[model samples]
Target chain A: MELFEEQGFEKTSAVQIAQRARVTTRTFFRYFPDKEEVLLADADADAVKETLVQHLLQKPDVTDTLQAVTRTLADFDWEKLGPRQILRQRDAMIASDPRLLERELIKQQQLTDALRDVLCRRGTAPDIAELAANTGSQVFRTAYRKWLEDNNDGDLTTITENVMSLLAAIMARGPVPATAARLP
Target chain B: MELFEEQGFEKTSAVQIAQRARVTTRTFFRYFPDKEEVLLADADADAVKETLVQHLLQKPDVTDTLQAVTRTLADFDWEKLGPRQILRQRDAMIASDPRLLERELIKQQQLTDALRDVLCRRGTAPDIAELAANTGSQVFRTAYRKWLEDNNDGDLTTITENVMSLLAAIMARGPVPATAARLP
Candidate 1:
């Protein structure tokens, strides 16, 4: 992350990265096939998804299920991660190529599908479950982006709560009057 | 869409599509550079974004501004689009390669950023705007997905309204109690 941030991802090579971390190029390759894997690693991604699913399943109420998922997400140890590590990694991925962004998005879609499946099993309508899953994941993502920007001080729970409130407010406003609206 | 569905995106050629549509190959090329553009032609995408921005600007209340954006999205002309047409495009894009999906996601991100900018301009904090934009888009997307699956029936406005309610319910529940007894 440091190397990518200071020197830019394109200019920095695996050899330099390995030397900076006091590791052999061979060791780096053994873990990550390419530079992109450093950011794309889903090692803990599955674990987090599993935790959310388990938490959601434990609550019978649909609302309670969402709350449980949010709570489990909030308890994640972002503080333990080295400062600037994630931001730098994000900068590198988004800067280096568009492909990384796509991979990240596909991963998000996968998570949504997994969550939707969980909701479906819990007896929610298929379409409603799909909507809930997508909305729930979006809440988590909104909170995560804020949490990322706050130098780790922001509580994920609070951010998630705020996102949910914002969604509710938007819903309460209902549809715009159709007669005056121009269809896009 | 028919050509792609009958065969596949990779197998279907521009010549074939042009022939099927009873249009000259010249006409096809004039509209789309490749076979992919048939699906990628987001003629209304920018217009929709612009309309949302304009609506947001017209509103004095920040909450009203966000709601206006959602309402604008719900008014999309999904009815005019053939269900098979959309499904074929989606299947082809998902099956062919990751690049197509990435491009779509980038487009979505652009929309989210635009929504965030509108909120920020309306006096909401930058972080809060970012959160609102993300959540707002999520609600829009969830409702749209449901609308699409149901053959685009049931007023989109109603679905959007329901999605917003769901978001609120999720948010109102908030995080699970930290000191509560653990789930069985």
Candidate 2:
């Protein structure tokens, strides 16, 4: 991240990165195939995806697709994904560059696809599965963003639960209406 | 689109496209800078953004943010964005490939950002604006997919309205409950 911030991603090479970390170039290559991978690295999406799929496939009784999806998602231990501070830095770097941001969106879409696939396999209605998967990811994103802002030690699971509870309340209340006619 | 379908997008050359259309290379370049632009050629996102921003700024009292957003969105004539058949083809080409899919996601994010900006400018809470913008875009997407699958002459506006109405009813009912033991 420091290298990226200082010299931009395109200018930084693997050898420089390896030397900065006091690791051999061969060691760096063994860990990361390319310079881009150093920033894009994260196995968390697959981890969360496998967990959600297993949970849904094992217990089809969770008829409420949204609840089941949310439960599975909220239970994820984010630590297994990566270090909290590094993950945050990775997100920040991704946001700072359009190409990286596109990669992030691609990752998000992958998660959505995983959720959608599991929902469909559980015999959830196609349309409902689409909505549930989308909503689950949306809630997860909202919670993740909040978690990043709150504190370094913030618990993502608790934050996710809060996000879902808030969403339920908001939907129940519906959109707030204006007092009078106001469109031009 | 026929050219793209015949030969993959990457394989098709601007000169060949120009020759097929009986236009000079200069004419082709004048219209599109590259081959990819043939698919992502529309400025539809900006046009809708402008309309929504103008409507929101002029009539802040139109309370119900989703309602207002959808109404403004529905008012757009699909023809203005591009020919119906061509738009469908463009969407198909985008969906057929992962790189194009990423571009589509980036476009969707751009629209969301525009909606978020206008909503925040109108004094809506930032977080609420983010959620509303995402929901509005999701509804737009659902309507678009249905329109593509339905009759060729279907009106996008009507489809959008139906989507929004369906969403309202679904939200009112909430998610279905599980029939068996819930997740631990």
DockQ for every model, please. Answer: 0.21, 0.14
CAPRI band for model 2:
incorrect
lDDT, candidate 2, B1-184, per-residue tens:
3467779778889897767655688866765667776744534556666776786667646345666556566666666666676567667756655655776788778877787788788887776666667776777777777777665577777777666555544443444322311111
TM-scores for the candidates: 0.64, 0.71
lDDT of each: 0.62, 0.65
Residue B134: error of model 1 in Å? 1.7
Name the top DockQ candidate. Answer: 1
Residue range B36-108, candidate 1, lDDT tens digits: 8674445445666676677666665665645656765676565444454464445344434444455567668
The most accurate candidate by lDDT is 2
Q: Model 1 chain B: which ten-residue window has the lowest total lDDT?
A: B175-184
* Candidate 1 deviant stretches above 4 angstroms: A1-40, A58-63, A78-84, A95-97, A152-155, A162-184, B1-55, B58-62, B78-99, B169-184
Error of 2 at B42 (Å): 4.8
**Deviation from native of the Cα of residue A75 in model 2, angstroms:** 1.7
